[model samples]
Target: MSKVSASRAFRRRVSLCLLSSAASLGLSAPALAQEATALPDIDIDSTAGRDSAPATAERIDRSDLRARQTGSSDTAKLLQSVPGVSGYSAGGFSTLPAIRGLEAQRLGITVDGVTIASACPNDMNPPLSYTDPQTISSIGVITGVSPMSLGGDSIGGIIAVETAPPQFAQTGETLLTGEASAFYRSNGDGFGGALSLIVASDTLSLTYNGSYTQAENFEGGGPLGIVRSSEFAKTDHSLNLAAQTDIGLFELKGGYHFSPYEGFPNQYMDMTSNKSWFVNGHYAGAFDWGDLDVRGHYRKTDHEMNFLDDKGGTADGGMPMNTQVRQAGYDVKADILLGEAGTLRIGNEFQHQWLNDYWPPVAGSMMMGPNPYINVNGAKRDRLGTFIEWEKSWESGVTLIAGVRNDQVWMNTGDVAPYGTGMMQMADMMAAAAFNAADHRRHDSNWSGSALLRYDLSDMVTVELGYARKTRSPNIYERYTWGRGSMSSRMIGWFGDGNGYVGNLDLKPEKADTLSAALTLRDGGEEGWSFKVAPYHTRVTDYIDVVKLQDFTDMMGMPTGFVQLQFANQDAEIYGVDASGSVPLWSDERFGKGRLSAKASWLRGRNESDGAPLYHQMPLSGTVSLEHKLDGFETRIDLTWAADKNRVDPTRNEPRTAGYALLDAQIAYSWKNYRFTLAAENLFDKAYSAPLGGMSLGDYNATGVLRPVPGRGRSINAGFGVKF
Candidate 1:
């Protein structure tokens, strides 16, 4: 069994033990049984006891979503339900969210506006998995259209995650709040928990959020039937402190995230641990000159990776690898009103990054004559940008948003010894190696622009239209990785001609055009009805994709022995529609309120270059949820259906996972002083696999050899939180 798989198996037993403890504490009671008493909605900015929208443009509170769905292993995965979004490689544990058919370098993820270094060279960190769900205050996504304050790092869309702030009451009394919860699954035996602390006084506040997760190897998809994986463990914690005064708000936050020895689906290497430290400072206030906000962030990441051959089972056969990245950023923005006709926002952003590594053959020898080798090709990159956005409002509750941004990126690729002293290159003792360690440096500048119009036709009906043009620069991996992506013992599994993979120094930026629309209805809790639907279409040009060259050689003609991947332009199209809403079932203040909410979504994409379905096209799916709350107690049930996916073309045999429905149940009790909850997912113990994947052909040869991908099975999770 792979180290990861063995570790997962052990965790399953632990999860079952925790679930037993929760059931005894009444954490599994149905919410429907507690309706004797309930609190009415409290107004944040309204004079009435009931809270109402402060303004048509103001953001609503989202703290209630925390711990809303524990035990549903896919709870975290649901974060990608935003318009124009898709998910790839649905491992039972960690999965990456793809936006507008663009991933990897085409996207950027940040915490409080600071970038987290991607630990795996093949992009396993993904842009979304960086933040813990429970710590999130609210997530805002701007598709096709972007706000200047983002610093121009986005291509298709921008997803911003804000940490929840401590809440303060009017009585001038301080409140201390905290909660803890855990759950287990029957199939994979997954267990996890989250703890939070919030302290708030009139003007001073502090908040902390932390979570740890562990799981056994999941049951195999039909084919792998339990492809045992590496032993996995992870822990993350975040702290935020803010102070408010009559003049403005001042705050600072710091966080630490770590994952020890996480396994990869199809790669040969395993990541020992990934650690990231982040700090952010901000100030925001409204003055006689409208409103102004400014912020700065600094982040440092320590990444370590290793490829162990296990010799299929033995230990000493593996190699060690280490890489570190340092990144820092600063941003500023101001919002000004123009005679109440509209608002203008202007901002500037600057960022820098540096990467250092010793791998392929750590503590290595060169392929030629026992020479020692050190890589100089991997080094530093810096990016800078300035932007502006304007918004106009009209009498009919109509708003127009438009923005433009420009950015420049500079890369410095230092030196690289022809053939690193790795196992593959050292085939011959008398081979000539290239010593031209050149500083291949280059800079790319791009412009992005977008516009959106929104109109509220009635109290319950709203419509929006949007369009945008954006460009993205090639990522470091696409521009610098030389020879095969020999990650921890596993070659990015990408073998072109297969001597070594070489990067193309001259790669172009990718461009995209998008058009989208949305319609929403707010059926005020009257009948417990609400809904939203969105549809979007995108056209891509100068699209950058991986082009592979098979077993090719270098200057010595001595079996260069590697595959080469170059970033080239390709054409593509992506379009999709998604709808979500809620409806109430049994409503009464006496028995407790009950409701059912459902979400349905679909997406379709294709390579304009060949009319084939684009990779990662999530099929039609829907989620049905029923919940009841009584006397500070809550109970709920959720059913999710995933459609069958038969359309696939790749290196590995992509199975068409059949349409399957998963069911779950949860119960929680809340008192003025605290709350506790427990949940059970995949209650049926349905044995099934969530099959998904994508692949590219390396024309470097004729017989297009397909590679393998990862598939996962049924899993469960549990989490809890509190307020006092």
Candidate 2:
């Protein structure tokens, strides 16, 4: 009787014969969620510090985000099953995400708790590219030491993402529900669709969502077939409203996004246009010295880049760039309720941003002629944060948490121009007159802290430990990009490694620290078997990394294209180990139930003052899976592998990648409210290359040899969903 105890007593007799056939069809559970049009589970609770203030997060729910949303519309690739996460490909919806080796403004992403930045400067609309992975529903991620109520800039940790709340109707019943989904993929023919709607009564509720996607250009099994500026298009829309009262709950949300083109096979421009808008608000209830939360947000973007049509459009006068942004934020938190063992959280946050990044003026150019190339004008950043946390618990099973935070930020800018002067804008007019003669305002303060502990040693083991420090600043293109020519520092940078940057106004404010640990083991209920690990280490301190300044040589002078960096502040470190597990093999009753899972990470980074190696650092990755279920059908297979990046980043000459493995499969089905899926991604088409996919520069001007950025061939996905 041990095939995991006879498959846990045959899944507890098939969940008691489906609850006695739903109580002989009387269906209670809100009348079986009104016979499957479901919709009735929206309890925001003001983010509960993103599910209990981090001590190793990693969530990703909504039924595992329904088979990976038809395989990818990027959304940071849904954090690739989180475990030291990874992703850095650009375009096809701006990939970026990275965790163990920290990436991009050093983590701390959010959406729905707001905090979105990256209005282009080559980031191409980050913040998970404005949602839309079928309109999100969960995503958590706290990869180690992040508390202080998840605020105070960032240092590689937090990532929230949530959407789908606003559900109501029961006490007087009047709820309507809806859902629809679609997908198609086949290399890069890609396609998409999504829709959702909900309406309720019993204290109001409303919801709506929409999505659209497109793709083209994808073909690669080697020899660089296709892949040119990867191609993309997007759209999303949202709305939400909620209210409950009697001392609590309220919500309001709004969203819109557009992308009329994406491209960007590793930087050198291509986004063509992006538009965004957002709104947010929230409130939670319960008092008597307990809960209470509040939030507010606003966002706007208007970005644009250039060169598309497979990277050579606008003839020779095209290299535009434009940016405009505005952001606003607010947050407030409280939890209190320290009687039965503790909980006392507190929060305050604010953000403000404004930017302008001009570039217009070509009309028969000369390195972009006649006037207007201001790079970053009217910038501004602003932050204000506050935190306090505490958690506790005991009764011989320990638990603790601690926090502290402070932020201040404030930055400034407003002045710049070039394009109209002589000698190809003479080094952008001496770097915009030494950035308008220095002192363009600046200020910071920053302080952060965190701590965690756990214990639990019995009931299937557990342990955890943590520490944090965190801090960050400098971004507005990292101390305002005043472009030192070389084609405006190769049009700024987002590190897709086509090199050329410039910006460092005394740049400081990185800080980090971290240190983590975790362990777990299980074998008891919920179908037995489990395992976990986690290990972390950070260091940072001023870390922004980059140096060089100019070098072009060639024709035997030996420097060969792509150099010119800047942003400085060294010292770094990173370390990692993540692991995951699951097992339960075989349970049959006509062939059903089986499982096996695994995950891996193993990262490393450096440059603690030139030890080199740290630019997209991700090597030794992993994934493995096997599954099979029954009754409602399911199948899985996966493999994914990496290892062989050859520790690159010799000051951004970074490109190495070799070593690969891939195979994926999926099959799904459900009945009752409908669901269907079919997948296959790289199932043996084996071409490789994409260790962070940097350095393609859209095929390096027709193969002038900079390489890296292949990966993606063999797609075939299909999806379906329904509910009404």
Candidate 3:
């Protein structure tokens, strides 16, 4: 058999060793649950048809776009209410969420309707991972099937974050509100506050938010401990202004975020230092023909890193690494109703980035020199895109939705500074290669399309099914960036070199074929409960994975463990279901007062080529919460558990992590316009890797990404807020 075939066979055998460990369970613990106003269902058809029925009453508050906090914790925690979703953790701040079985760039994130580019090398800045849960008022997670205005993508899903509309002071009332809040736990501490003031007569409003956080290394609860230097801190701020007038609404916003050291949860790259800022303007107006919307946005981020080629003798000898990246981009979009039940969303987006990379020479670095060097003098990327979508609901509640998007991108890598000067040698080779090749500016184009149909059986029930063809073109990192990843932190010994991994410009786009179905229910408007279940499976073609290169030799003439890895295309499959609902304990119409709410989700993936489990198939997880409110004070306790996952691909050494549970309790007291809150996570001190199978990498590198990072122990966080 060929070398690649042999490799596949070996991995298959290894995967078979743990196949029996795959367990199964019911869709969810309980089926029916109703409370919390059925979460104010969204009227997807409202924007589609100008003649739609008064735009189906909005069940959720839209002005609630600001100063509202839910899920009291991480992004995954806050999104638990959404069906068909789950998340896994590689570190304290790193949360990798799986929609069905898809992840990475396959998922899209938008803030206040503008796409905010992510700079994380390991796919870590998922929507929830970017901002604190308290920073926004309302959140919507669209799994697999999303609106066309969003460019109609994500085999994994799309996340939309919106700040509440400005609430001007009443006609005769002056408004003033400010509050301080803080959170601390076994792993970290954070504090922040928001303030808002408004004058009634002019219909003008102002708001501002600021926060700071600091944390130490989190413990990885494993038999062989994984020591982590994730100790880090940062600050964030945002300002907003809005005015309501007879013609329309106008708003402006500016935001800033900075971090000195942000650990990489992906085990491949880390940000030793970072800063980002953004500004935006928006206008919305309504008329008899339809609603008109327009927006202009600009954003930029600078990233710097300190890297070590490898740890734990995984390489011939560890090498030092470094990088600096600054990206600035601007985009514009307009949404105008077409007529009746048709609306067109058209937009253009573009960006230009400048990259400055450096790699200092090592005292005894090998490669034909006493001290060899590699780095990019500079690099650039340009992109443009336009897209549109439509929606319509027929009589008897049958709805149809469709959308399409096309995007074009261009990238250029610059020259070397007179050869052998530190980190400049690679430039000469790059320019030569580009000059000899047909294309130095690697160009790519991607197209996406999707269709979904839903039939409302009754006022209390709805069933929907959908299919989508989507493609996520490789970003700049996947196409260029010579030598290795930022900081040389990503050392994979499996490839035999342990030198670390690098990006490839010749890589192809990753695409997905998806099919899904969703069932939703609620008892109408009368003392009813809400429940929804969604199941989807995606076949990823040309899925990207880091292929490692290892075969280094030590001075003794024997094989050494160092390795290098690069992105490549492969096939994979993801399947799973999400079920969640609120179980009421008391009814103002029935009991005096009592309540119960719970949610559960499961995600699984397999390498289609060999049927091996993917690296991070989020474990079967569930949460149960009970709450009680007395007058103005409310208290709740939650229990969350995940099942065992030993079925893993041998390549990644997926482990056999035992199942574990955690207790999270909270208390909130409120009076007048003030609210006090407290929350706890991993309260029992139980420790286990969410994806324990990841630990196997440690065998190759003493400091491998698989080093078991600790799950947090018992911890408590408290905060307070006031709404004017």
Candidate 4:
């Protein structure tokens, strides 16, 4: 025991395990209010039928981010009206989200807790494209029972995005703020703008923000008009710094992003180039034996893809690709205050990832038979996590939360060669003998847990219950992709679904068990009226499915009967329900108020080994609205619906969607700090298709039959903003 006495005996065993679990539950410590108000280095905005939070958490404030900021900056389409969300359109700004049906590395995206990695291995740079929905101030979602200190690994759920914090100025004050906004849309003659700035004193602060977007080619209503490659462009920037005293708050941030072009009429490449950078640091404090936090981040990316101009240009039989990634992470936490009812949080986290995927040869290429073709050449992954959480409350209204987590993942790869010539060099020598007979270093160790309860049966009701045990490991392109036979599988495409994938180096590590429930009804000044209903169920075990492989081969080795997929381990189940409400249909003060709202979601999945049907599930959906206000004007109208996805999977032939309805409208106005908006989206141009919008690889209609990828035609948007 040297090394500074083993780091002072591990901080005295974590301060005696947080003071013996808060003095054996007789708690204490809730009386320190001498100018206190600083807790936002990260706070997952709790509120989903509140009663002290977590009823499958959901929160999106700032007037729902100013009513969705009038059309796409693609923060996952602003969570697609949020009720178990769904999305998967790879252009006009990269929409990808999916929860309740899981998606992409099984969902656990963050920002401001920073975890961002996706330099397109067919993901087109998702992770909400490194955030920039006008510098999001709030957005949270946790559908499904996520806990274990806000989800680790993942079982599909958790999205957090935050920014906007750091303001201090008084006592010999000095502050200066700014904001600006602009927007326009009309079926892809799109436009965008955003900016923000701030400066402060009374403990230093500074910030700068930016955004830009562009679009073209998007018109789809009847006869499948336009829609060619569904164009796009993007840019983002950030910088921040902060410092505050009396022992707390410190921050630093930096960011940059760029996109030279983007387009992906549903898969098989398109996204010319993307570049990224990031840096982060944070700290928060309140001690006396309690609250402390720290964070760190780093990111880098470079992505590229090709084949557009309706999927066959870029000359010489096209098919370009490139990817690069590097990510880093850190987190540390403590929040011990147990007395007037409990609170204890302990954390540690670490992440590291590196990647590479290549392809570039040309010069008399016939279909990429002899290019550079390395495809995920030196992959790596590492994760280490720890968590422990507990919360309590009593006085007979219940409320409890519990958590536990542990993770250790490691993956490695290197050494793989064989590139093109006859029959693509015998298909890269059988994919380098199956990547040298697999086991290119792998490891996994996981454990997770969660529990929640909340009760309050009066003052207009509340109830909640939850349970969980989640884990997911097996990403590194699902445990390494090593092409074979005819060579498809460029790291198992992430649901832009025009299929072609392979990966499975003895994959395993996906375990889940969940149960959840919620019910809430309110009226007693929490608002005029409200309602909620949540339900969930899950059961998975080694479920990393994606079968469909009746024989394949493409990319010049020929044979393509067009079905290829691989990544196995089965047995699964999923269930869901979600509902929402709001009411208040009239008011006075010279009659200027009204309201009504609704939401719905439904889900089902199976493949509990042969029960089939669990590929891209998400059908039954709903939304409705009507609103009005006065004194600064406001209005709304909405109606969205869906149902008719005949549950198809049949070995990933999955296609069957028919059911649609949509209509939208909005208006707003404000004075003083200024605001203005106008929206209309798809009001009547209906030619629907969106069951997770997949399929359809580049242009065709008038019954050419490669359908399922429509929706987007009647638009009318506008925006405005100001602040000073």
Output the number of the lDDT-best candidate. 2
Local accuracy of candidate 3 as per-residue lDDT tens digits, 152-201: 33445766666545555546545443333444444443333333322222
The per-prediction CA RMSD against the true structure, in angstroms, equals 7.1, 24.6, 11.7, 25.1
Q: What TM-score against the true fold does each predicted structure earn?
A: 0.80, 0.33, 0.78, 0.33
Poorest lDDT segment (10 consecutive residues) of candidate 1: 47-56
237-258 in candidate 2: lDDT tens per residue? 8888878878887888888887
For model 4, residues 529-636, the per-residue Cα lDDT tens digits are: 988899888888989987766555545876543477788899899898988888888887777888898989898988888788888888888889898888888888
lDDT of 4: 0.75
Error of 4 at 298 (Å): 39
Preferred candidate (TM-score higher): 3 or 4: 3
Candidate with the greatest TM-score versus the true structure: 1
lDDT of residue 550 for candidate 2 = 78
